[model samples]
Target: MSTPTTAPATDAASAETTAQAHGVELTEVAATKVRTLLEQEGRDDLRLRIAVQPGGCSGLIYQLYFDERELDGDAVRDFTGVEVVVDKMSAPYLDGATIDFADTIEKQGFTIDNPNAGSSCACGDSFS
Candidate 1:
């Protein structure tokens, strides 16, 4: 697994408080999709969480899911009643990034366009 770029946490408490602030953009298309999914699940308390994890062909991979619990150092924003959260460690990598959904005969899913990523792998699942 590729290590996070942030400094090592001295302790659990410190780790929880050490997240740097950053903004991640969620397009209307993406927010609508998230809201629809949450409605289908009958969950009004869940928020969409996006994170960068280690694994995949590239050093880092993207993790997206619905989370009801908000961890320490989590950054959150609301778009059209849809809440999106990003962990402290993953904030830097996703800053200024945009998430969009594409629905077509060939492609149907959420996609991330991160300006911070220098390059991505052939599978389009990981990035540096």
Candidate 2:
């Protein structure tokens, strides 16, 4: 491990860097929520996978899906027992991303707090 010298949580772009352009932060709460969801679905082989794909309402779309397969250039980060794989192509754009789960009265879903996005679409399905 290098070092987590970035500032505490304030804005999303706290650790902006040119070398490791993209940064991601997976909250413990989110990891726990994922573990519970996997258990409920009886998918022991499933893991949360986050990726950035081109062509969306904006310039790019944030893709979050469950994956069981692993390929080359994939960065795997394990939290508790949950695994998150970021593909090589998407890693750069998603370097400083924060994965979180929210269960509120309004909307209950997983949210990706990415600082790389300069702008987001109206639907919130994609960003640039």
Candidate 3:
């Protein structure tokens, strides 16, 4: 017999309310890589922005990219050596979220673990 798995809390509105509502942590390795990138760019004004966009099989997708601009209504937080900025609109969808980096071949990249998502699609794209 197989045991059933229960989902995370169905509501994460508070955590998703603002950029500072919850904290996101970065691994030492990931932070170091970000630091190196900034040093190489010779620009400290850039930030690592994480956003949730509509698409993917799960009806939403995670977007990780570098941004130098802060638009109206943005949640910004400093994670050790890197500044993580998530737009206001994307906050609720990504509340209680953590951005992590893995060096292993199986998961060698930046990944977002969002508590707000009820379920992620089969391909790890989009979420309910």
Best by TM-score: 1
- The lDDT, on a scale of 0 to 1, for candidate 1 is 0.87
Q: For residues 1-128, could you state the per-residue lDDT of candidate 1 as single tens digits?
A: 99778755567556544433457999999998998898899989998999999988889999999999888789878788988899989999999999999999988999999999998998788999
Off by over 4 Å in 2: 1-22
Give residue 69's lDDT in candidate 3 (0 to 100): 89
Number of clashes found in candidate 1? 0
In the range 55-126, model 3's lDDT, one tens digit per residue, is 888788988888998777787777786888878788778777777777786767777777889999876757
Off by over 4 Å in 1: 1-21
Model 3 spans with C-alpha error above 4 angstroms = 1-23
Quality of model 3 by C-alpha lDDT: 0.76
Clashing pairs in 1: none
Model 3, residue 31: distance off in Å is 2.2
For residue 108, give model 1's deviation from the true position in Å.
0.7
Find the candidate with the highest lDDT and give its number: 1
For each candidate, C-alpha RMSD in Å?
9.9, 10.2, 14.4
lDDT tens digits, residues 3-102, model 2?
7697566544433232223356778989999888898898899878889888887889988888998766677777778888888799878887899988
Clashing pairs in 2: 22-95, 22-96, 23-95, 23-96, 23-97, 24-95, 24-96, 24-97, 25-97
Please report the TM-score between candidate 1 and the true structure: 0.82
